[model samples]
Target: MELHSHRMTALVLLMAAVALAGCRPEAEVAGGALDATDGDPPATRTALDPAAASAPITLEDVMEFDPRYLIGISYPPGMERYPGLAAELRRYAEAARAELMAAVEDLGPSSEDRMRAPYDLALSFDLLMETPEIVAVQAGGSLYTGGAHGIPLVARFVWLPQRDEMLTAASLFQGREGWHEVSAFVRESLHTSLSQRLEADALAPADRFRLLASGGEMIDEGTAPEAGNFAQFEPVPGVDGRLRALRFVFPPYQVGPYSDGVQTVEVPSAVLLPHLSPEYRGLFAAG
Candidate 1:
């Protein structure tokens, strides 16, 4: 969804191409906006997608007519081979779908707000790096549920086929203290970036202070000393096949305003090695 009208128009057109093309959209509302009445019969004089007079609103109808409810999912080149991972990704999309259904129920069929910003979900996966050591993947997308903009969903998975489990951020560190160390480093980096951006904009002192104060709070909370706060991290591999760094990913509204978009801080191996769990240390080259 676009926060601005012009962008909204553009995104709607693009979404028709990108998102509508998948999930086998419904026939009734198949063409455009959900509550639109473009093809009403002369007798009806008025109608909506899933057109109340045409048929009852069912899940299938929603999927077929409203492209918004149609979850668009795409996998990387060889992700299908891993049934476990594939199932996990599908579950994520299904959850969003369930939520969309709930919202539809909340907003009755005749609600005008339903036309404001139709709900939607689109996910894409990138097979960042795959090897015997680890199968690193990054999954990201947007979920729109009638807002000015869609909420971002992002995740990083380091699948260990040998261990038959994921290498989560919490498990990678020795103890709670590791989070504190990484938190401090990431917080500093993000704050510095925010300062540079504010200065570059050359706003008045009052505006600068207002932005810095609000942005600082978000960065602090988003980068707090907790594994959950820094849940999404991408592993950067070195030539030697060892992890050279971890790029922590913070979705928009987590570390800054939505306009600022997603932000990241790449903590090199040297900065992370000290706090890494003994067993996990082998995943990285000595920094």
Candidate 2:
């Protein structure tokens, strides 16, 4: 989601400035543990001024868009009355359902719980799709006391089926008290899948080194109750105050646009560090 801020006074000043001068993207590179070359390359960084006194912010500093910012999951304004919204939502829902089905096919059914498993789940799947973003203008004043304007988190991309897919597991557990029987396995499977996928991306020796050499950025997209309360997200900054880093969900990579949902995607230090992985120590020396 994007927001535009204009102060009556600042707008006039900006106009005058723009009329006289042009703007440029800023670059400020510094030594840090999280180097740009080591992680997901960031988008362009444009700073107003490095010497100016103001809050320090970088492209990676964006906050997540969560449910707290939504007005409900339906169409926004004139759209509900507009002729195309319902059809559009239906289209997105169908696409999302197809994607989910593909994921289910990949996972297949678990040996024991055919009902709860993806291939043979007892309950049905329900998809939830949120409306896409639209133009917005604030008629009122600042949301914050300090004259800071607040932007409603707009839904940029949404393609969930608008239905929920739930599978009951009581029969599989044989009347077990809780999820203890399968929760851990499910978590492990997700973790393993995510790790392998990330590792596979770094197939080349240089690529492996690049990925494991540095710490990447992280973002906390706010929660959205309307979209089944799915968490929102933003990319984290690299050491150079740049918006450079891969922003993916952890674990269940099958369901996310960016991340798979596991906390960190990294090669074990033992695997990357020379002495830790004795067999690879000589390999590092050669490099």
Top-scoring candidate (lDDT):
1
lDDT of 1 by residue, 126-226 (tens): 56778777777666655556655555656666666565556777687888888888999999999999999999999999999999999999999888898
Error of 1 at 108 (Å): 1.0
Native-referenced Cα lDDT, model 2: 0.24
Relative to the true structure, how large is the alpha-carbon lDDT of every model?
Answer: 0.63, 0.24
Model 2: ten consecutive residues of lowest lDDT: 136-145
The alpha-carbon lDDT assigned to residue 213 of candidate 2 equals 37
Predicted structure 1: lDDT: 0.63
**Highest TM-score among the candidates is held by which one?**
1
Clashing pairs in 1: 25-64, 26-64, 26-65
User: Per-residue lDDT for 4-56 in model 2, tens only?
Assistant: 22322322342343333223232122111110011111111122132221222
